[model samples]
Target chain A: MDLWVTEYQTPSLGFSCKISETLRVEQTKYQHLAVVNTDQFGKMLLLDGMIQTTEVDEFVYHEMITMVAINSHPNPKNVLIIGGGDGGTLREVVHHPLVENGTLVEIDDRVIQASKDFFPQLSLSFNNPKANVIVDDGIKFVKQHKDKFDVVIIDSTEPVGPAIQLFSKEFYTDVYNCLKADGIIIAQSESPFFNKDVIKMAYSGINNVFNTTKLYLASIPTYPSGLWSFTIGSKKHDPEKVVFSGDLDLKYYTSAIHQAAFMLPNFVKNIIT
Target chain B: MDLWVTEYQTPSLGFSCKISETLRVEQTKYQHLAVVNTDQFGKMLLLDGMIQTTEVDEFVYHEMITMVAINSHPNPKNVLIIGGGDGGTLREVVHHPLVENGTLVEIDDRVIQASKDFFPQLSLSFNNPKANVIVDDGIKFVKQHKDKFDVVIIDSTEPVGPAIQLFSKEFYTDVYNCLKADGIIIAQSESPFFNKDVIKMAYSGINNVFNTTKLYLASIPTYPSGLWSFTIGSKKHDPEKVVFSGDLDLKYYTSAIHQAAFMLPNFVKNIIT
Candidate 1:
């Protein structure tokens, strides 16, 4: 018997992975979550039938999402991650010695529990002293904390269900208020190829709230399109200009890559601008 | 009735598209060819159960493959494209004002026929006065020509069947002899994620024959990984430096993108070096 887990990236397009076993599947309070062991991508996580991450390519998504925001800030001491229940973004945040505290607010406790059980490589950071894992709505958490964080990384899923509010202009305004004077917020904007509307929506919302807004790209194979975009809304610092010079042992993010990521292709520029 | 076409990118992974109709399917002399009209990606061409190009996303692959080499050369007048039967690369090549003549050598004539029948946007280049379309083995054609071309673009499918020799060192050595002193060669090296060994092989072979060899990346969604790699082997000019200042109204490639594409992430750099 052959078992394959397929994510309908669109109604017309699907990405399937052959799975050796379905490790876990449960309908949480928020969404449907599943953990499966795959032959090609190792262990995989799915939420609402969409691929959240795989053990093989999580480094690219995690490093690109967190390090770009973390390194762009001048002195990123306090960091807040919204919806990174898997703990991959938190792992990257805590890796920076300058990041004194990293707080993650995820609404789904079941995702955190599943990651803790099946994805130890990512969930290991949950035990770190610098990492504070919280189970609550991200919007509420950001609204309560004012001028506290140097960087806020929105590691939410697509703009659907629980994530619909996360992509709105009002949510960005709240995030902007939650940041310090020179705070930077980086959100995983969807693929420029597949989700132009979502990218435009996120960019427009973020641009309206922040002093400077820029869109960058990274290649995450498991995403809807392998090409994923991240929108950075900065208060003072320019993400194109690297403020932090220190280096970390990383798989994807480099000074060159940091600069290159901001160089948007002409077509992608058209979508956001 | 639901009609979907899925390309098993690996035994463990598959990418599928819902098709309104299978426009064309035939066992060519070289390989099996199918043109699918997809709801999401428009018309897509598949060869031997692999995606060759799509109407919506072909611009990214065609522009990146041709413009980088054409603009990098001091004067790219005579160009040769091996295995680009779809005429997309030829279209980009002929668009450049500097290119006096563009020759496309495709082993299979049926791909050209299908493209002409179903993909007029790409196949329109076949009628250009500057385009010289030839149906022949690219390897043999390269062996016969000497010091004739300014740029050679290898727009081949994966390293299998008829394209196996296209990735060989001996073939690249022949291509080197076929180019003028300052000529450049750009080949679509497979994805760094899915085809690491192919990338390593192509890079090693090209590096051995060229004075300056560099690997670049572009996001091509229909391909295995949404991220695709292109390898450039130049005899005298560095691909990083743009020599042609004249701009075509292009969607993907730009002067900044030319330099930015060469910026490989550390993990990809690790694969080549």
Candidate 2:
């Protein structure tokens, strides 16, 4: 009667939730996938023994990742999401009336299939007529497209497994070329508390290819260190200077929170800047 | 050879750390206490199956609790900490050049004993000549003192068992009366993400007593939701408007973060306000 599912956030730190039953499990070509019904978090999607999304706190991660860049662009029409297999980022993107077209490139097909089966609320956007879903490598896809997207959002996992190349300078340069002259990109950099080196690497890598770059903080409890960071790189648009007055009917993101997220703590400031 | 220690952040959600060994376990008169050697968090202290402090992220909790109020008051010579049995707040207060004296009144001597024995870095200020360490009930102690201290900090546990009275409206009034005419009080308000009702209770209780009350946030991974909040009540000083230009050789607190901490997201703003 006491069934628990655990994610080892670090080599030693583990987070467990009580589970009513395991919904599905499969071995994808790229990673292992599992879906479970948890007593606390509702439903959870895990990839390779790590928490990818939870029903309870996924709103915080999805909203923070999509809205900041979408709202910052003056006219966000063409939006691109890289490696968001769960479709949460795409779900938030298609909410914008101005986003006429949105595309998602996820390498793992099983991750998407699992989400579509178990997380219908998040996978709603996959059926939108304005959306295009691709099962391909994001690094190669971005390199082939030039000056296409107004906003590029990377919703990849930790810099491990098949997604390791997404953090490279070369891949960022490709993303820079794939965006419009005034486009913006937001990638989930790891935590400053647990992954200082990854934060430094992502900031430094994105800084080399963009005209303007900024790093922001958000609290995502399911992640390794609940304190998570994101790097925003823009060709011309300054995310910190942009403002939004329209109603997005959001649960977390706001114009005030957009500015406040950039104000990092002293130790985190030392790492990025 | 798999050993696990679990802390139920809520009744349904659990956080576990792989343990190499359990250092100490004993039942105090007030609550149960345990010290464990965790692979991820180094040494950790637990009270009544809840995490009190961990060596890895204790800096975030201690620094946020002590430095904000100390720097806000122009001349913080005298300070009082209620229920900080671990001496972490006392240690941070002693770092200020303007703090001439500090007092800590903790209910259980056993918690202090556990801290001194396991958490030496945090318990470094127990023997400070300017500090007065009293083992007594904090609610009774504050009621007997009037216009005595420049700052009063309540670092008690959650509103359970003996500490439930500390979060009541009557107790906050006593804390207000214990301070000087232009004094400030800061209490560890629970997370708005998980403990919404508790946060509401603490915020509304403090708001009734102080002319200016503000809520701020910090990220401590071991705590529930990883997004922890604090409420500050002041007679005249606005915690939002205070300026600090000195260096405390701190790892976390800065003037920029001091400002950002008060900038709540729209959802949290709706809750506290």
DockQ of each: 0.90, 0.75
Q: What does each candidate score in C-alpha RMSD?
A: 0.8, 1.7
Model 1 agreement with the true structure over B1-273: per-residue lDDT tens digits: 989999999999999999999899999888999998999899999999999999999999999999999998988999999999999999999999999999999999999999999999999999899999999999999999999999999999999976889999999999999999999999999899999999999999999999999999999999988889999999999899998887688999889999999998989999997
Write model 1 residue lDDT over A18-123, tens digit each, in one string: 9999999999989999999999899999999999999999999999999888888879999999999999999999989889999999999999999999998899
lDDT of each: 0.93, 0.89
lDDT of 2 by residue, B57-145 (tens): 89899999988888899878999999999989999988788899999999999999989998999899999988889999999999999
**Fraction of the true interface contacts (Cα pairs closer than 8 Å across chains) found in each model:** 0.87, 0.79
Give every candidate's TM-score on chain A: 0.99, 0.98
* Clash total of candidate 1: 0
Q: How well docked is model 2, in DockQ terms?
A: 0.75
Which is the leading candidate under lDDT? 1
After superposing candidate 2, which stretches have Cα over 4 Å from the reference? none
Residue B93 of model 2, lDDT score: 85
User: For residues A130-187, could you state the per-residue lDDT of candidate 2 as single tens digits?
Assistant: 8999999999899999999999999999899768788999999999999999999899
What is the lDDT for B10 in model 1? 90
Deviating ranges (above 4 Å) for candidate 1: none
lDDT of 2 at B44: 92
